[model samples]
Target: MELFNSALGKNITFVHPKFFIIGGLTGIPNITFYYVFLFFVYIVSVVGNTVVMAVIYLDHNLRTPKYIAVFNLAFVDLFGNTALVPKVLDIFLFGHYYIPYNDCLTFLFFCYTCLSLQSFNLVALSYDRMVAIIFPLHYQVKVTHRFMFSFIASLWVFTIIAVLISVGLLTRLSFCKSVVINSYFCDHGQIYRLACNDHFPSYVIACLYPVIIFWLPLAFILLSYLYIGYTLVKVATGEERLKALKTCTSHVILVANFFLPLVGTNIAAVASYIHPNARIINSTLTYTIPALLNPIIYALKTEEVMNAVKKLWKKKTFINTA
Candidate 1:
């Protein structure tokens, strides 16, 4: 590119590959069975997230700042699963393993953008709950639709820019080594390491992405809850504390589902020698299972969402009968 040429100068002759072979999940035992299972996951994820989004959209009572984040979260979950699962099935199940370089980067962009947004969306939800619980009287003024929309928009812009910069850095890499990417998709780390030239920038991103996208959001959620707990203890009665804490059950479950497996797998990989097959499976599931479970958890655990769904169903039934 003109940008790449200008940045790296005329002396650098980059060996940009025409295509990358996705070799992850390539040789595990009975991988077809896993793909079949993922097929069903894709199905349920689509249905559940669709229902969640539809319910939020149709119900006037559910149109709060909190449900805005919930709707965004559901949308991201659906988009992420759609971006990931079908391509994965195509790559391994149907034996279409090769992806062009530009297409690969585009794939990485969609998948990672959606992935990052999931955590950011959770942060929004946590913030919503924190303000609602800790500053109930001021919540109306503090956590308005305008504020949430702005906050969530900024989060989206931030995630997109960070991911774009990382993807751009890959353009400078000269892959003199094997073109076979070790991860399931066009993984940033696997692709960059294959480059023969200086890849320190890519390496930095590989290290930093986890912290920015995962750990930071996780810490923020925990801190928000700590403040919520402190405020509840200082002001509310014991019964009141329990009632307030009950409101957070759905968010807590969502947080645990999203963060724990990712943190756990990263910790395990760092602490010991993990097999490639096992590591790949864990990482894949970490990306996937949460999307499948998020809407289900929210719908069942939050009485508001359940009631909204029932209300929408009853209205539909009434219209049909008329």
Candidate 2:
């Protein structure tokens, strides 16, 4: 056992002790109920996102540059949720609580990548809205399919590269002790906290990464909306102004829904006084809640999506009556 531990430790600097998830520690009287609730949420998120993508793809009218961004956002939500939630369920329900060291790092990489992509995609959506609202005359000329495709490609490439660099930096850290991560899944901050070596550089990068990935895009979205607001005010027609405002509102809601929980999760993770259960719940919600809500928010709030859904429902009802 000593030789096996030594060999494994030599290859991978740290092997974590079996980590306890927040869901398991929430002190709920009936743990089975919590697992059932989470399982239901996971199923809803998957089905909801998949339906959004299908609706967008099947409806030829909805396939605009703007909806393309929406489609991509839904895709990210689905991908991100799928990547994290199953492992969380495994930990909570199946008692597969101990994640191998390398597996944890791999999951962390994809989670961060999805988060970065989601943020960048939101920024792209803001830009799409900005152009459509502020420069409607030139929007067609400016925001081409080619341009949107290239922009999305660039977002994926950039995020993948950034995550790679971050993971590379993480690899350099030594974890001599088996630490227990308090949260569900492998949260970046929680993983970083477990490192036995000097974490100053990792800490610096971790702090800066959220700023670059989350806040910077958030700032861009806000600035774009500010200009959008300014442009809406100058519009002479009340009808046009209302229409423009309605278009941007959904994007704004989605942005808030995604970022607020994200920021809150980070805060709860770092704040010493915050309960571990709260941090875990926050982290779990940060991924699952957004995934479940994205489709519902877009479907209800965005006019095109609502119309498409109505049309599809009518078509199905008509067929049934026939």
Candidate 3:
């Protein structure tokens, strides 16, 4: 770990084509330029997510539970992107691959913690939508400010405890020298790969934690929508029914697209633990593709988000014209 800050850290040991894809596509082969490219992504994700949150916050007309849920989701995502991207961009720019031991652990802890929080937030949002569609009158009282605040507080507490326990368990192990992470960030799975001791517990925890947290909520989201669709069919009014159906459809699509890749990646990570080839495929789906596609997914599926973005853009243009 002491070698992290030494001049030797500047020497590049490995350069894979996958890591240089952005540089290749951009026709700029310089390693320094790749750092700039990653920073561009970091800036776009932060700005776009921040705008989403701000739109939800400033627009009193958008103060429903569904949109409030979206606001919280965007807020968590903003934190998520910030926690991971800066370190990654810094490593690329400075040509320093070594992180101090404590800093490495801290990075892994918070990154996974934020990732857990974001996934849980998605689950909560799905439940909120489910209630709104399945029982409109009940949703107001059920998903009130007080209730949501308590719910979010509980989620943070639970996630922190789980992550701390996982980290404490991890801390007991010693890391050997094979530290070049195939993934951009120091993810828990990647970090565990370097552990010199028995890794059964780490693998078990990694597989079980995500499954319990992500899959359980995903099951609920799927079931809730199925019931919602059934109930919608019984409604009498055509226009009112269409409105309810449209909203439910949007929520279902968003939930599926988000959870499918997430769950698949988690499972793939387990397989990758055994087979090296699987890790590369999982890396592409988990890191590269999902980061780029999340905003596009929301825009394509949710008219509300699309309209809000358009409104925000037109306002920006008008201000510029003035």
Candidate 4:
């Protein structure tokens, strides 16, 4: 747990531990159970995201640009869960926080790409919904399958450029002093803080990327929903109107689940910057809580997926009975 140390006449403090949670001490009751629980969680996350994507693929009715965007979002979630959860499960299993510098850098890049791309995917989904609701008659023509594919491909390109810029900047930073990362995962902000040299460029890029990418898209979602709501209120009336309203409710719920925690995480980061103790709250929100909430959101929002799962279970049950 030493923060700084010297090894063989050279300063070496890369593996020092700095912070400890109150309940994370060794010799806690049944610590093996936590790893078991984390394994189950990872399984559920991967399965849920995979099933959602599959449902969108196999169901012909679900083959629209709106659902295409959803499929991409689900794909992002798949990668996102993989990036963080397995490493976390390993940490829980081993009770060690050893991460090699090169591995750490690669892990950070992959993790950042997943999280950042997921954010972008959600924004794309929102915009897709906005266009459909705003122009129902022209929706099919405007957002052709070709257009959707092109858009998604562009996103992958842009994300790679953005991530390369961030990771490339981080690589240029001098890690002269030490290397041990404090958290269960190597978060970008936390890793940036570890650099013994100046990190001004890293700071500017981190702050600007989130603002331009996440916040602006969130604002667009809010604006799009408001317009949709106004349009719905003006036109909706009977059972058909009620059905029309239901179309967006699921998306709104998904958007809220996707966005609100992130907003909270950003706020927590600000609070931590000001108060220091608030980083725990920030870390919990960003890393721990999101892992559980994402699958739940998809399960609750996608009724078609729920129905398919139900059908799948019933079929398995019938076969077993026979």
Let me know the TM-score candidate 4 reaches against the reference structure: 0.79
lDDT value, candidate 4, whole model: 0.67
- Give the TM-scores of the predictions, in the order they appear: 0.97, 0.86, 0.74, 0.79
Best by lDDT: 1
> lDDT values of the candidates?
0.92, 0.79, 0.65, 0.67
- Ranking of predictions according to TM-score: 1, 2, 4, 3
31-97 in candidate 2: lDDT tens per residue?
A: 6676677778878988988989999998999888888888899899889888887877777677776
True-structure RMSD, every candidate: 1.4, 4.7, 8.2, 6.9
- Pairs with backbone N, CA or C atoms under 3 Å apart (clashes), candidate 2: none
Model 4 worst lDDT run, 10 consecutive residues? 1-10
Q: In model 1, which runs have C-alpha deviations exceeding 4 angstroms?
A: 1-12
Candidate 2: count the clashes.
Answer: 0
Output the worst ten-in-a-row residue range by lDDT, candidate 3: 15-24
Clashes of each: 0, 0, 0, 0
How displaced is residue 292 in candidate 3, in Å? 5.3
lDDT of 1 by residue, 175-206 (tens): 87799998889898888989999999999999
lDDT of 3 by residue, 1-322 (tens): 2343233244433211111111111222464565565677677767767777777776676777677667776766667777776776665555556666567667777877777776777777778877887778888888887777778789889988888767655555565455555555656776666677777777888888867677777787777777777877787377877887777665565566567776666676656643444444344334333343455556667787777778878988999999
Regarding lDDT, does 3 or 4 come out ahead?
4
